[model samples]
Target: MPTEFQKRAGVFVGLVTCLLLPMWRSELYCYTVLCCFILGGTLEYWTAVYSRVSSLQDWAVYLILFMVWVLPTMAALHIYGGVIGHTRLVECLIIQLVVGDSAQLIVGRSIGRHHVCVKLSPKKTLEGYVGGFVLTFMYGALVHGWSPLNISVVYVFGCIGDLYFSGIKRRLGIKDYSRILSSHGGLLDRIDSFMFAANALVWKAFFFSPE
Candidate 1:
């Protein structure tokens, strides 16, 4: 059932795990991995959205888009004064993303009646929004073990972030940023949820948290 892209991506992800897990996981290591993932994902996004872009211009668009995702990462890594331990920050970002995506699946399967964009992504719906919110909030509960925040703040912002990126994809007239992920699509498709959730986490940790 898996497409060629899925098989390839699965392998690549496995490779990444092997390559990175042995390094002892420093902030610098996290930063580098985050940087590469964002850059690859951004390239996928601009390529998918800007339909009129030529292959030559893809580089330019990618470079421009890279900034959109990168500055936030840098800020979170360096300037984020939040008391979030590295493990907590990582856990929150990854978990919220997974929750948001699971929400999409639930909404699509159940109440996704109205088309999100009609043409761009027909299955996306307000129902999915609810799913994403609930899931994201629930996942945020995991962070309470290590950090601060009530459920409302965590899921609300996290869901908004996922929807924000989803909206961007819809407007760009593409799906999943790229088909590079096969069933998963490009790096952007997989990571958009992460970007939104990470940004939300950064905001909470640096600006609002009493800790």
Candidate 2:
């Protein structure tokens, strides 16, 4: 029961992922994939944000903020040659983004109990947020290493990032960004969590991590 866009995107993602995982040895491999995701994510966000705007100042401000915001986040996630040379850091974040958001939405819609933001996204509940956090926290335990502090920070930021963009949806006066995906909204609609999650993880890994 997939929409045409979802079906196409799903197949393409599967194909690319299958091919890309093996070539993770190359820095270019992971960078290319993450770059596509960032571009797509930013585009969806831009579309959602700009769709309702009628003012030039609003458009200019949003454009500048997006470039200022998203690109730097993607750059931070790219693990180059060094300790993380062979690490599939960027891919790991993207994977979690796919799984984490999808699972949270399913849970939130079906049985979520507490409300995240009753005004912006009434569907988001505390249970869904908790559920998503628990899932991603476990993943972060593995991905962010054994540091308790790092794991906590990553979880908090990931959830906050999702909520942050939800505000953008409210500002733009739209729901789901677009109807392109049957279950999902748009690319940015989905990857908003990754936007902040990746930056938080990178920051923790470099500066805030335990010695």
Candidate 3:
């Protein structure tokens, strides 16, 4: 019986090896990873919605699902494949997100005192958020040359994305979208914030990037 941390670490190492080994030689591999996220996320989302047995119409549910999961994923593909024509920038963003998320967890547990949203996410705190933001900014600025605006977009929308999914889970009366990943819930649970931030970056790059 593996512990939760072991499961997480094992999966993470495998994923990193797969992504980094062939990432530079072939862009298709990266797209495949994104597609997996969207597909898994969509399934988990649909399962949650259907299980809730809401009074909303089927069309309404589908529309919400498309907007929340599918649309953002498509937008991300466009940004990375068509618009930017490279995965380097997005890779940096992913690294920053990982760093920031870890920071938030560590700082929140260590010294966090004020909850950011008690109703939506009880464990999230203002101190944690600030710590994550500061560290993310430093890493992105120093290592990736990410502009302040880009860092801001990722941090802000990442928070929004996490809360948005948390809201869904709260409404659905479930702790996770699925239990596929052992202690980590599901693929969607891990990449929800990344998906949202990626799509937000898509729009920013589309309208703002001179390239």
Candidate 3 per-residue lDDT, tens place, 47-160, comes to 877777667685486558558667656766766666655565455445445666776877888889999798899999999999989888888788877788878888888888
lDDT of model 3 at position 195: 72
The reply for model 3, stretches above 4 Å from the true place, is 1-12, 57-62
How does model 2 fare in lDDT?
0.63
Per-residue error (Å), model 3, residue 16:
2.3
TM-score ranking of the models: 3, 2, 1
Query: Higher TM-score: candidate 2 or 3?
Result: 3
**Count of backbone clashes for each model?**
1, 2, 0
Better of 1 and 3 by TM-score: 3
Clashing pairs in 3: none
TM values, all candidates: 0.66, 0.72, 0.86
CA lDDT, candidate 1, residue 107 = 62
The collision pairs in model 1 are: 181-185
**Model 2 TM-score on a 0 to 1 scale:** 0.72
Global CA lDDT computed for model 3? 0.74
For all predictions, the C-alpha RMSD in Å is: 5.3, 4.4, 2.6
Off by over 4 Å in 2: 1-26, 48-50, 77-95, 106-110, 139-146, 178-182
lDDT by residue (1-211, candidate 1, tens digit) is: 8854456456556644753353226665666666778778656665664565557675576556557666786676565334554555556544555445565666666777765644444566777767766665666666445333534554556555556666666645555677765676777666665665566666665777723
